[model samples]
Target: MQHKHGISPRMEHYSCMVTLLGRAGKLDDAYDIINQMPFEPDGCIWGSLLGSCRVHGNVVLAEPENASNYVLLSNIYAYKKMWDGVNRLRDMMKTVGLKKEKGCSWIEIKNKVHMLLAGDSSNPMMAAITEKQ
Candidate 1:
């Protein structure tokens, strides 16, 4: 696409390339590309690698030593329905003193906005919601 459009590669370009290559199971290639980057790789780059690792069911790349990567790995594992991986990530976070933020959601009904927080029982429909779920 770049060649056809006469566009030059940039950080965004490299990031997308790394993500695609990692998703395709070319981890070494992705890692090489990341290493070649002039600046330090950030959380986004690590997230791409960790997501790909989870998709491929390869936990080796999700080691807890890399905290940022571990967070992404945990999210990916959660999406992939891997309870064990999620639990491992939770444990790692606890051990490292990384507090996992509580999840929250908001909904609007009859022009009124309702908010829900993890473990909060303030909602009037809390009983119904819990029963349904």
Candidate 2:
């Protein structure tokens, strides 16, 4: 379709293809696409591929230093109840001092913006919120 429209494939396009292929259990095809891309695959591309691998229970891909990549892989291992894999990933992160950045989100309620962070418990109302939830 891109060729028909004369729109050259970009990194995002290749990444999408990899993701689709991975989700379809066509991991080999996805890997081949990554290898055959005209340009170097960026972290996003690799991350997508890794996510697919996690879903499909394949861990043959190379590990990148990106914290998010490790997090996704660790989650995958955890999903499969593979404590060894999870511990190994955790150890690697600790050895390299690679910490995943805390994610934050904000919401506006009645003209007031409230901020929240992943695993954040600093808020004074956290206990109340937790009890309510």
Candidate 3:
């Protein structure tokens, strides 16, 4: 698009390109495109690569600080029932002093806001909530 129409490519376009190349097993080429992007890539870009890596059994992560990246990889390993990989990632996090913070959600009802943390069962209405779900 840039060369033919003078229009810069957006993140979504790059994402699609990466996904396409990744699905075709052109991981290196997909990574090359990410590197060439003028703007810094966000989670979506890395996510595209990570997904391809999972499918291809290759882990190529350029980011180190984001906890979410680790979580994503861990989730992939868990999905595949690769217990060893999951444990290794957990150990790596401990060694690196990285902790995955608990995720939370906020909901408002009757003008009152309530915060709920992931895996939290302290709420008195937890049983009802689970039953509702």
Candidate 4:
């Protein structure tokens, strides 16, 4: 359709196609799109591919073939319970000095938001929140 209309496909459009292909178990086609895209594939694109690989147990592109896409791709694999993928990603991270960013959360209350970090439980009612959960 894009070629028919002489319209250049946007990054988002390409990403969406990749996502759809992944969802449909057309991982080979998804990988082809990533490899053939005119623009560089971003983390989202690689992440989508990684997710498909995990679901299908296809390790063709499971390795960090492209370093730039490693971070998100590794994460997607990890989320899918691929320990080997996680280890590979960790090794790549060590090689590139890329530490996983520590997770943090923000809570919005009364038009004001409070940021909470992993170990910094500065919330006044931390005990109450834990009890409820």
Candidate 5:
């Protein structure tokens, strides 16, 4: 449809297509789309693919460079009681210096947004917020 309208599909479009295909259990099709895209797949595209891989229990497509992919695959292996796989992934992460990033979140109060990291208490208003709760 895009080609018919003389419009070129962009990265986001390709990523969305890949995500849809993956969700539908069409991983091979999604992978083919990624390979055939004119532009190199960016982090978002790879991330989507990795997420789908997790959903489909297909870690063979995961690459080591993407820390998140390794983490997800490791978690899947752990869930399936595959200790060796989990340990191997952890060792790989250590060798590559890819520590999983801390998870953070944001909330809005009184029209202001506050960023919060896990186990964080450094924010000036943290005490106040905790007291209020």
Candidate 6:
């Protein structure tokens, strides 16, 4: 597209390619694309690769300051029943004095935003939402 169509590769295009390649287990290629990007990889780009890593059970690291990445990686290991990985990750965190941050998410509904936190079932619609799922 860049050479033939004279179109420049944008972040979104790179993100899509990374998602596709990573999901297909072409992790190396996906990473290569990220490294070749004209700009620094953003959260979405890294998130795509991390998600693929989770699916394929491949251990990978993301932003060092983002505790969520470590938690997600640890959870992936737990899902795969890899006790050693989970233990090692926890031990590493302890050694580094890194604490897991509580997960929080927000959704917009009718132009109003609602926030929910992990392990907190205080949302008014929690019961209905849980039932629907």
Quote each prediction's TM-score: 0.55, 0.70, 0.59, 0.56, 0.73, 0.64
Candidate 3 TM-score over all chains jointly: 0.59
1-133 in candidate 1: lDDT tens per residue? Answer: 6679988777787889889999899887888898898788776777787778777766666544356666767877787788998898889787878864565788775777777898889899666555742
Output the number of the lDDT-best candidate: 2
CA deviation > 4 Å runs, candidate 1: 1-8, 64-68, 72-88, 100-133
Report the C-alpha lDDT of model 4 over 1-133, residue by residue, as the tens digit.
Answer: 6769988898898899998999899998988998899989886787678767767766666655455346556665666787897787779778878665555777765677777778877787555445653
lDDT by candidate, in order shown? 0.76, 0.83, 0.78, 0.74, 0.83, 0.81
Stronger candidate by lDDT (3 vs 6)? 6
Candidate 5 collision pairs: none
| CA RMSD per model (angstroms) | 8.1, 6.0, 6.3, 6.8, 4.4, 4.6
**What residue pairs clash in candidate 6, if any at all?**
none
Q: What is the per-residue lDDT of model 2 for residues 1-133, given as tens digits with 9 covering 90 to 100?
A: 6768988999988989998998998888998999999899898788888888888888676365599889988988888899999999999999999998887777665677777788888976556445643
lDDT of 5 by residue, 1-133 (tens): 5758988899989999999998997888999999999989897788888778878777677664578778988976776688999999999999978987666778776888888888998987777666763
> How would you order the candidates by lDDT, starting with the best?
2, 5, 6, 3, 1, 4
Please tell me which model should have the higher lDDT, number 1 or number 6: 6
Q: How far is candidate 6 from the true structure (C-alpha RMSD, Å)?
A: 4.6
Model 4: lDDT to the true structure: 0.74
Clashing pairs in 4: none
